[model samples]
Target chain A: MSQPTTYSLSARIMHWGMAFLLFSMLFAGLAMVQSLQPWHLTLLGLHKSFGVIALIAVIVRLVIRLRTTTPALPDSIPALQKRIAHASHWLLYAAMFAMPLSGYFMQNAAGRPVAVFDLFTLPAIMPVSLPLYGFFREVHALVAWALIALVLVHIAAALHHGLVKRDGVLQSMTGRKK
Target chain B: MSKKTPSALPLRYAIIIGAVGGLGALVFAVAGGLGQSSVTAQDFVNLQEGGNPHLGFRRAHAKGFCVAGEFVSNGSLQPYSIAPQFTATSTPFVGRISIAGGNPTAPDLNAPVRSLALSFGEGSSRWLTAMNTPPVMAVGTPEAFYQQIQALSPDPETGERNPERISAFFAAHPETQTFRNWQAGYTPSSSFASEIYHSINAFYLINENGDRQAVRWAAMPTVSNGETLDAANANALQDEFFARVEAQPVAFDLTFTFANDSDDETNPTVLWPSTRRNMIAGQIVVHQAMPESEGNCNEINFDPLVLPKGMAATADPILRARSAAYAESYRRRAREHFLNSSLQPSPQKESENNQ
Candidate 1:
């Protein structure tokens, strides 16, 4: 029987950091849609900063994973389950970039300054148009919903790995060994 | 175990580092460098038709024939006031027409006008609030109006006010021709007040029988040439209004032209023909020579929808939508003002440019 190796310190940090960013982005997006009041300006600023950071972190995370050899799953785990895990992880990565990118496109289409949390404006990425904005806005909203759904599944899978499967799948990231 | 490729790893790392640095610099540059003044007319992009679902949905919701708000006639104000022979009610309302721009200096010459119709009035009373630029809007729908306004704002790419885009809007909405006749002369370099016309899409007149009937009103500036004033004749209207009021409190009559049916929504460009015979229900005088005070002018709420008993608005969806949209605009403006106290600060403390 082989024990699972713990995740590296860098990987752990990236995971937690990205989690915080995603959570804040969700809240900021909600507040932006709800109201454009001055109070929300702070949240907007944070959101803008988060998006840029996420864009950077996602690129770094993918690079780091490619450079390091991640431990193989326990032999007891089915091949189907391994494949599922791989697919889900990549999906999460895709979502990280998709949400902010779509949002950027949406702002560009609206022709308003992408005032990220009042901290600064994003460079113009596109020209304003009714039809074009409509297209990007729809994509942005859809991506947001997809991300939220994926997040729910991720939390559920993490719990399942620990509680039902009684496997070290979830514990490896937590630095615990079964 | 296979070793990671040094070539791939460093390249990826470089890209990540470069992107982070670039993005960080951008965020700071945008935040620190762009001041409030940076939000020029160019920042406001013209919203495309049906492009912004939120606005489109709102405009759709606003469409419908609606009326309510009655004005209390002050019997003493004679031509301006309803007589004792007719019963009158007072309902103060607020109305405003704005050109789509972040700043006042943005050219008012060609952009579509957005009218805010908000009147706090009696249950059955409503007002036909409208814009001055477009004589008649496309589709007579609120959503259409909103979409139109969004489209005339700014170019999404360059963030500049584009005349070509506005011309396209005018082309699409041909009904705006009549209003075009009026807005053509309202150049940024010219005095706006002189060329501005007071429009009454609908009105309530207390008939001889003591019952209220619907009406429409308009104030055509009978200029020195009996035509619209050019920018060259600038400040003529402003000078006249101030000088007359200062010399002696002057009164102007707001005559009412009643319409039997309330569906004047389609024909806004056509002034409800006064030849059909409208009684002089009352007149409104500039009773006081009041200078333009920010507090007084900006805060005061006026809606045509506000009316007294015996007076009611006709069935016009555009008018109906105005009630809600106008109120929301003010509500948002008030909130914006509260959050950013520096907005429209005291004239003395702020830049002379604000004046």
Candidate 2:
């Protein structure tokens, strides 16, 4: 058995799809807070919808990742770099789930409806508790900022592997050859 | 070597970390006291205490006059709501028009916001609605409103707003800038009858099918916009409103605008777009304006939460907080009125006692 040269097609699609969704959610979240009119509401809905989609997508990605064999890092890669990559990937998965779940809980605790695209509504599970609502809201905001930072670091590492290191590590996810 | 079938150890670690992270967040929130309790009726009372000096006047919109009118429904509101006022051909109404601030003697032209509060129906089934000239609320939440009042209140030592304190508050809550900007842009209407007033809180309108839709309403002046008032005149709006109504009737089309998927149901500060679907439910025709001393408006609380069937309040915290605050203000004013009557008799009453 040999190490694979590239990621599976499904993995690549999920990676790119989530990248786009996460970035859009970040931008929309920031804009919504500043906007004082109908546009803010529009951005908020989009952000929530995308967040839910990301949560589901991350779960599927995790399952596929567990099932599929991944390409091993090049032998020349340092142990510290490998460890950092593993830790960041795990943290990203944690954040993907945390953001949407926190938002949903916050909305429920605030006694508000969580509608999906305004087509249907999710039942409020948490009792109306402002303390709980505030707690979750703060968590959601802090986690989002942390997620943004982690994503930036991930991009930098990928670019370093692709551009400076001239390694196939980046190509595994991008499906591009060195 | 094969990639060891992507060891489940990492997956297990990921799940463990995620759970730990979530648990840690809750612990931190509780420990750090980030979970402050919700705004209460006492907070509102404290807010009024900081800003309101006139005990008998409203916390805001203290200067006002009452008008007797009737609402003539267009019969088009059945599709949106089944509220009896919207269904009736004509429902008698008593309304008050007011200028924002706690000082009953505050010059009308200096008031940044104007308001209208109306009650439809003659008895227990009455529907009350309160509206203001601003299309959207200044603050989004009860907490923010409390902070705003504190920031705007005069300093105990200086008897003036502390510039640094107010600026810090604005910096912390930039959303309040929208309200300030709206106020800065306002041009005072010559008379209350010519100003368009908006119900900033989003409400749920239930139709005959029991299906609910979110909406915000506005009373659009049927009369054309009045000339901008001269700021030097202290009682220009009231004088003009009285003279205008005496010479001719004034009216407004009670219009409801449906909320779109993008409209926020919980935040009153976010104004729905003008492009949203709007329909005129009825017309409010004011036939007579009585002097403030003779008017029932002074006694009426005009609470916004007093809703009829087929209409419901949204989850907006600011809207919910308003009911509590209004009730508190009403209680205080009523108590003050009773005390004043007992301590100092009116001129007529004093003369009668002597005779």
Candidate 3:
């Protein structure tokens, strides 16, 4: 069967939406760590809200990805390049899910309820354990850094395909394929 | 016609994604548990030990008097806040009036600032507030304050602070110059009541309508009767304070000033302008005074984090840090007899005749 030329509509929406949310999360997280201003609390709430959104979006995106066929790499692409692309894509997915799950559990371990935009409280799923809280907190931070690095690499790869190689691979996700 | 089974691609992707995600989580859990450990309660204990050789003294404000008082509410505060202490007609309070510095024997003449730490209400509903004479704090964040303390701490071998370290800290944290200037501008008050005590950290006041306002409170003396004493009478402030309060209650107007858009709630080092709207919350009347040993103040931690309903702490790192330091001080003091000895009533010394 011939590979699709572009991602499905649902896939495109989820991809862009997650991109905006994750970017906001990264900046908010950084600001909260550096300063303890009155707005810091507000930013923290937003960060947590975005994290939850990212988690849900990633799950939906994963399901959609499983049902739909991803556009194949151009025939000119090297086998090594294709393998690297496949591995990085999976790693990004792993980081996206890990960041929020770790943060949610970390807060629970610290004996705090996760309030989504102060609209509703998510009950603590785990018992209060300082050690567990420390572990999860570290994991959340470390995964965030890893995710950032992966995102930069992904962006670079896409630019390489679009600008350097003049391949249609980048346009497959962008929905700009002719 | 040959027809292939429905493609197994989706199932294969699902398995691969699940396995990779599970593996990533496992790696993070193990790496994180081994890599980052949160600061423990022991760190605070160690910090205190490193700062002071005198194990029984407080980490700061080592010299103080235990006083009994009542905050008489004018009832005007009811609209702005529902805190019982602010709205009630009157609520009895216990507090310590102390001078800045960790030396219990530090002369009142040389002390840079005075402090008032009070606990209002009784039992479970009690609230604690630690205030100082300065309108703003010396340092903004907990880390900066901690570094300041470390910079000023005496060198183990020299038994005096290294000048280079102190200068480096001051140069790096230029904001602290405001606090230092404020301190240098004032002479030590002859009485704690004569000085204006400010709750340097900003707090949220939730009104009856559920409207929240950011405010910092101050207790201004109603009377200016305290007599200035010279260096020869270095110990006169506390003595005179006790004598005056015993003769008549010393009172202060408890006022709250609302924060404007320009105000920085997190940085206590930044003082809000006086032009901001102010309201008379109540009056704090010190009816009686006693030496630290005779008063119940030693038992109280006076952590600013302890708040009644309608009063909440802001994201001020210094305020949050105080809670932990105060707790550790209270814990260590409670365990040792030497620390509790300061609370034991001592015979009053003969007054020096220096008019």
TM-score of chain B of 1: 0.53
**Chain B TM-score (model 2 vs. true structure):** 0.81
Question: What overall lDDT, based on C-alpha atoms, would model 3 receive against the true structure?
Answer: 0.72
lDDT of 2 by residue, A1-178 (tens): 8868888889999999888888677666654443322243345556766666777898899998888888888878989988888899999989988988998887665444555664555677866443455467677778988887787667667756654455678889988644
Per-prediction DockQ scores?
A: 0.03, 0.02, 0.03
Top lDDT model: 2
Candidate scoring better on DockQ of 1 and 2: 1
lDDT of 3 at B315: 81
lDDT of 2 by residue, B27-135 (tens): 4454333323455455566566665456555666767788889999988888777788877589988889888777676788877789988987532245788999998
User: Could you give candidate 3's fraction of true interface contacts?
Assistant: 0.02
TM-score of candidate 2 relative to the true fold: 0.56
Candidate 3 wrong stretches, greater than 4 Å:
A1-178, B1-45, B51-56, B230-234, B337-355
TM-score ranking of the models: 3, 2, 1
Task: Look at candidate 2 and give me any clashing residue pairs.
Answer: none
> What tens digits encode model 3's per-residue C-alpha lDDT throughout B218-332?
9998877566566676557888888899899988999999998778887899878879999997889999999866776755567676676677778887776565456455445
**What TM-score, to 2 decimal places, does chain A of model 1 have?**
0.86
Model 3 lDDT tens row, A29-75: 64444342335446655777777778888999999989998888988
